[model samples]
Target: MMSKKLWEGSKQFKEHSHLHDYKLWLATSKGLKFKNYQELWQWSVTEVEDFWESMWNYFNVISHKPYSKVLSSHQMPDCKWFEGATINYAEHLFRKAKDNETAIIFGNEAGINQDISWLELKTKVASLATYFKSIGVTKGDRVVAFLPNIPEATIAFLAVNSIGAIWSSTSPDFGSESVVDRFAQIEPKVLIAVDGYQYNGKPYDKSNIVNAIVDALPTLKKVLVLPYLNTNALDNFPKHYENINHIFNTVSGELTFEPVAFNHPIWVLYSSGTTGLPKAIVHSHGGILLEHLKYMAFHNDVHEGERFFWFSTTGWMMWNFVQAAFLMGASIVLYDGSPTYPNFNALWKFSEDVKIAHFGTSAPYLVACMKKGLMPKAEFDLYSIRSISSTGAPLPPEAFDYVYANIKDDVWLCSMAGGTDVCTAFVGGVPEYAVHSGEIQCRALGVSLYAYDDHGNPVEDQLGEMVIDKPMPSMPIYFWNDTDNKRYKASYFEHYPGKWRHGDFIRINSKTNGLVIYGRSDATLNRHGIRIGTSEIYRAVNKIKAVEDSLIVNLELEEGKHYMPLFVKMKNSAKLTDEVKSQINNQLKKEYSPRHVPDEIIQVDDIPYTISGKKMEAPIKKILLGMSLEKSINFDSMRNPESVQFFIEFATQI
Candidate 1:
């Protein structure tokens, strides 16, 4: 099956793809016919309501108030989508606002690249939705931010979803106790923050963590701020402050669009959970506008004046999945510091000075640029990179032969995985398949993904539990104050009742039909009875170039004792020696077995991630199984809460 294809797509380049003009508009509108892309993803998940009413009539969706049907209750926590749709996810990203095009392209760590236009992004989102309706704000209210991937955080999240409010954000390097444990569970009412942030070249002012998240958000009522890195930051705020550049130069008006109600609440996105208080989730505004117009026209083909770029952080979910490259009129490129600041070829020279064309990142930043053997195609001009993707984790297949041997043998590496519970990707990249090395090149179109087995059936290439049986128009329409749905039915339908397990650990590769994942099935790694998958010990410790990062876990003691361990994090003065623990136990006993090595190898000066970089493996296996480190993690949602005090002092010597 995997005849090692690495790149493919040609029937005259898949007939100038947009998924081949959406399979010739579903064969001249629904006469249908699909002899590939797995029969158009099995008729898009077995006719999920005539494939979401033909994706609201092949994306001409401008419904001011239409959807009265097209799925109501098909299962999982009582499904309901498109019920009386009133649309307006920021009027479909300014529905073709083409004034001087280039809508957003920033950059930071003071490398500088700026640009904004679409008539200065629709006049700064109509002067921040006329200063959020002159301070009273409205429709669903909330609002949030502490902001960073700038263009004033996508012009204040398209002016707080163009007035039907409710947005959320975090990244001012979090910590005001993780931005008041997720904007004090969404009781926001406008905060917009940021008088800080520089990173890797250091600045970090955060006016006392924005004056302690404006004195721990007492249902805020306007705060604004934004003098990025202190210009006497409105002389230090907190008495109901203001200034966000004087309300974007004196609040102009008329950028209206509040049609809402297609499952309203537009953003919230949290859940990098290492300990409680994070799952605010939410997502709607027509389930992320039909899942970002079907994930940017079928798993990111994202064309129209394309520029894209996704080295995210306005607290990750790929910055709301790179604003789905403004739903295909593309452009989006933001940066805001540290993609290895002034090093690791700063985002391949910011994707060769911004001719990006769908770059997106993370899979441990392509395994730390393939363990620093960095070539990035001999330093730049990546031929306007068409596709490079790689989502949060589980990529390791030698970072897919280091991107076709040093970052670009005609790119297209993808390697995706979905998270933030469906902010997109349920398996990724589908320009009509064939980019094999580490898999994941399909399964997205209407994602009814499988790989179940542990008795929940649906198997395929073994290693299971990554369910999802249908229901996805970007999943979460709940979570904010999660009550009656009881933490959204224990976060993903209590295991397998109606499906959607999604705590990772996938497989389904039947030789490149694609999808491999292998990570978080709640940090699984049984050992002697075999269960593994910490990306199979990070693809055998990312083939040990003096292992610069690693984590592994296991634990499960008593009567069938397991333990495991590993840890690593070496590089610089590279000492983990004993010949690097016998070359990491003979590369996990020659690539997987010897029960995939371990039972303690330790070195650790780093590891514990999650400020969206993830890999805090179920909070370090709930702190080496004795739990309690404030009940296993959440040191302000940690990026390195001091690399978690050497795993809480090696969890009290095991």
Candidate 2:
């Protein structure tokens, strides 16, 4: 099949592109000509220091102290950026704000929509920051949040960062065990939590979970609870616990942004915990600030006053990205509860109603909408939307077609792939370039992405391990509680010994210079010594009208034999007939390879997914390999934990 260009950059879009402006500036100041995005990307990867220095200036990053050097050294793990510079993350987010402009728009599954003006948001953050200082919070102190995707979570994070205190957060849906496993490692001094939260029109009381977490964390000096679900929920808790209103009402002060070193940790992000206990990946104040500004302004092409919305919980990294929209002077749209509470069109209708300019969500949501044949263009007035981004999984080519054909033909659809390690996309959308179906427009500026074969040599147009030859500004400063940097090294550098191995299977198209991600390399299928990406199989299986979703795992059996099984979730009226199986096999053989066909195709009730909507492939593979459920995955991190039982039962029969 031939690839189609979905959208072309208009003159207005080119004028708004931060990258385009930078290109013009480069030609005028540095006497360098970058005629296209490809030439600009080549220079960016070749002269890394110059590119980053230019980015720092282009974003107009506010710094209290000048850096002694642009880069201290070229070491992978020890690369120091902007040495001696001091800055505060919250300062950039709240700067250049108009009092009357909207800063945050909150929406819930129950049709609750509210907006907070810039002045109101600033006032709330100032009050919380003052209260935090009164409670002995200071630089390097940890403040953990177990809250929903409400305005309070954003305020708490800003307040924590405003004082140079490190912030960490997880969704309220996580159980006490999962929450403690993450927050306990950091030894936070303050615990910000919700009394309860609502999802899919059902209220869940999280008071007990918060109590358990507070009881387990000995370093917690104070507990602040928000009345999220039920207003009276906090009354049942102990009197020692503080109410959110008490802090907001008694404090009155201007927010002070404490300037710390560029490398000073700002927040701790946890891994998926599919293999073992979650790794607390810590990011710095200046590193995250500069990175997010570039990612949001240039890659997303976010203009001031544009409405940016991404359906995410506080647990996901995208929520942190959404917070960065304020840095670009853009209004953030926050949504809590299910994206499809009433129906699959809930988000589409809401996006139209609110006139969201830039919308972000996962590939699974788009794929489900495509399979159900939901015509969003016919139902909703989405002319206000300029771009839509999909992540969390590889977007099937069919989903790409569905978006242009059924959603909007003129809109830009970006299928980006990045992980929690860097908290940004290595390959993402570039508004200045044409978007091809099922491909990321370009490698993000300043990110040195290369696909490496087994011998550690770079290759083009062939799927291989995705690796970074240089350190990104947003790479984790360090892992919390990881002394001697042993765990951090083992996680990324162990495979290649020096470079950053991102653990994803990917290829860069030679013709279009676009990125096509296969699934995670760890979950790739290897049959008869031939490796195949899971996306190749998924593309074929998901094309069948009957299949709703699918999963495949390669198992090593007795006598060095192998068995590759494919589990499929079918539609209600569809059956896994022999003709259907034959069609799938034939499609795989013709499109991918003869080896792409699985040994057995089994029907399953549902596919397991993380709370962030990623297919739980690695965790399921571990469970099918004889590992117990508790050891494979944390149940609290799953959207439907019961779906894991199907794999465990299938493992027994094998």
Candidate 3:
């Protein structure tokens, strides 16, 4: 049973008057019938076929060709969903009427507010589609975007999807090598980018990097610049490059769209190649549409006309997830600058201004806000916010408490966890579930997620691997350039046959019926034959007020023995005094075992992170072992790549 006090205090557990009105209809709805989450989960697995079929009908999935069958069988890997169904992904999203209802809200650190209503967004998308069609872009063609989270980027994405063209994007912050590494594999015919971008009150010109990428990728036929900063020289195009206006001028008014099969590829998302070259994970139109709608409507409790905001770039999968809100006719709020630009409460102020219903961000952003002593409860009237969802990393228990105490006591704190491998989440929150301190509420409705021991058997109350036992709608259709699915299989299925090993070390607490994410299984440290998670060490070390962030890794000694070594990154105002180091050691020894204590605690300036703001552990490990850093994937925005060299020197000397 859930704690009564916890249940009553959580906004998720409170009665939703909207759901109450739809309860009777939901109970008797054509494809949906469930009294509780458990019933839906059980029916989804036991009667898997009927469950998804019903979900499709309930969401009013617009398919040109009706599905011959809902599912093929109960097989984990081979199960097929909505076989023979034909649907246009864009058709479902443009369901909103041509009215003045706000569809997109764009903001930045420079105090820019650009709002696009449903009718205006439609017009822009149609104009862009006309442009693409004029340029001979037809069905199955690919268009690449290296742009920010501006309105133009969203318009480009919608236009490509509308005309059945595949869309792929990465943020402008990525270096030329990283951008080329990804777009080269896709062989995109058209490239869309901005002249420059602004972050933290500084402008960055992309002419050099963009020109390099455009020249290297021979398949790129055209370059369309959005003109963010550089706009004086009009005709600045290479031999094969053409400006966006030049292409738009030749666009005809006539638009032709082709509907495709349900499994047709819509977008290609790249995995964070911390270890190697990033893998291009492709997602289908129909599956992504259906699954995102389910997540937005039921899981997020998003209603039509509600305002939704997620602080993410086009590179992250959350950007795609946020764009899906338009399918429900909800207005999306977008920001394209540093969250702490000018002030720490930039996002909070935007939320208050937009009256956002659902606010999504990263764990580091919240932790930074906490460290800055930001209290939204005192300054902003964020009553409109019903849910706050966090991803990119596991939410610390203290962060959860900080949000409830300082942001809104009654708001739902959702710690959603999934990756680019699957466009949607495996474990997330539901509107009716009770929010725990540090637990993702439940497995996604139709997603089969469980903790498995080394023997591949399900386990509880202990740390183990998190695996999805069955395939869901949003599983990647295929990998780019992987002709025989070899790369796809090796990426996800090599660890366990026919099962997705999600690479998370999680412990399910039987007492509270919650989950505690220890850390990544690949990054798990082993000393004296005992496996330990990096988060255990982090949780103890970060508790010290002097430490801002830290990275823990296993260092192999000369005798081939392994010991835990931690690298601490202190704040600008703090120092790594001997007293603080001793305190860290004492805390670790008291909270955990002596083995959990680090052999050395060295302070650094900044921890290296990926473009999506995740700590780059594998690369640091490679650096310590004196290996090549070239193979370290996604090194575009490493905070301090040179610091790895110093770490290696220090390790050798020690």
Candidate 4:
């Protein structure tokens, strides 16, 4: 069935974790005793208010004012955490910086860039924040950035947060319109952007895209551009633009912090825009601050001054999450280019060179390494890697085997599953536990997650909907521009009526007491380990006159393989030619990225729809995965009853 013990924590490993220290403090200070992790976890979720308050006290959260209440309401869509508390998230990042030898390590695909010291980082952040204030950027004002995974992105984010202004960002690779769709909704006052970026050893010049994006956002007051690729990047712009270098050149002002409420919005992270537009999900400063502290120290088991790196772009949530390593006083590593530039050994080589302690990446990257059969342990010296974390997709059991056998024998592999909806991991690793194959070590403390069946009943040891019965602090404050919290409630609470339905299929094995996530339960496209919405794809596909209608689905097969096929309905018996396919692929790439291009294009009679006139993507996804036709579709609820049979026959052939 499964291989024996992938990895186990030694006695030293258990004692070295933050969990050990916290438990000791609990017993000494609060007189709380627990036999094992489950007992501790039980106390965490059961007594939610007391548990979170302990986290606040244990971590010693520096607040401008004391909280009147730990939690105002326990219900979803209304939980006001740490109400009446005033705190600044950026204040904590500097607590470990006084011993500042180095705060951040920067690297590119080819080699290491410059290492930024904590003093330098503080200076730049102060300078930028001063510049922002001079330009009228105030608290709660949105400042958006279009950049890559670089030191500037981190600096800008910290600067924005330090001044109590809101922050939002996406990768520079996004098409101009796609960027507009998300940023326009927020009505950001300032635009921070890069001219271009390098990926897979090739340079992408986005000077025109930046100009186009700026043109679309009428609310933008001032545009500051980074000459990342060409020095004359701003020369081509139609209007005058401020050089981003001005702030760096000037000596910074006195670094200051603005005290805001605990529930004040820190940053806006985007969803896949699956329905219409990308949901601008907002996370509070204190919520993320608390969550990140717990996750980085306890779950990841990272010590201060250790080098932490996760391969991520500015667009992804992990990029934001990676910054939390600062809360642990860890040196965060930012690598800008493709993970597999010269070869698959690119990131691995960088890890060895940088001596990264916490190596964070996606499951797909690990699977690729397994397929290539590249022995990283043999090829490079990865002795500094204390732990490895994978997210954005499920890590197959075989990939777990590969890590122990081929990468590092004793290294801890923490395969966690969470989304942009929550900036922190819902279920992740516990340093005190054994590393079981294909199982997340534990559900995060203070998160009440359970596998629920369709009838809203919690089920054990069976695949069911991932639901959270208790409110987490890191849950969204509200969607940007959402009126009366309507969209926010519908996105999460509508499914189960008060309980958050996370749209992920998961099962908790009774034997291991660990979680096994089966990927998203909905129609969101899981390509390249990132969730993409169908609306973005359909927007590009619709431009083709030959295609009248279309539907796209991502099928998660065995061996960590993903099959995404786009079924197109031709217009008026029009032919589906090679030219049409090329047009579709190019448009998607131009609009989004290469990941948006589907693997296969097949002609279909029509696309399926529900009785409410919404695209019936979830049912088609189940049918193509070989579920029985009767279970996959109900004729009474669909707009077209007979359209689904073609997919049923087609599934057998594939």
Model 4 regions lying over 4 Å from their true place: 1-3, 523-654
lDDT of 4 by residue, 36-77 (tens): 888999999999999999999999999989999999888888
Model 4: weakest 10-residue lDDT segment is 609-618
Q: Write the per-residue lDDT of candidate 1 for residues 251-297, one digit (tens) a residue.
A: 78777787988888888888875687778888788878887888788
Q: Which candidate leads the pack in lDDT?
A: 2
Residue 606 displacement in candidate 2 (angstroms):
1.6
What's each prediction's TM-score? 0.34, 0.98, 0.94, 0.82
Q: Where is model 3 poorest over a 10-residue stretch in terms of lDDT? A: 1-10
List lDDT for all candidates, in order.
Answer: 0.82, 0.88, 0.79, 0.86
In the range 1-654, model 2's lDDT, one tens digit per residue, is 236777888998787687778888888878889778888888888898888888788778889999998887767887889999999999999986899989998888888899999998899999999999999999999999998898989999999999999999999888888889899999999999998888887889988888999999999999998887788867879998898977888788997899999999989999977567899999888888888888887799888999999989899999898999998899999988888888889999889888999999998889889999999999999999989999999998889999999999888887888878888899999877788888888899888889999899999988889999887888998898888899999989999877999899998888888989999899989999988888888989988888888999888777989889898988994778898899889989988888999999988899998777888888988888888778888887777889988888887887
lDDT for 42 in candidate 1 is 86
Candidate 1 clashing pairs? none
Candidate maximizing TM-score: 2
Better of 2 and 4 by TM-score: 2
* Poorly placed runs, candidate 3 (over 4 Å): 1-26, 29-35, 74-78, 233-235, 239-242, 245-257, 511-513, 556-560, 637-640
> Alpha-carbon error at 407 in model 4, in Å?
0.9
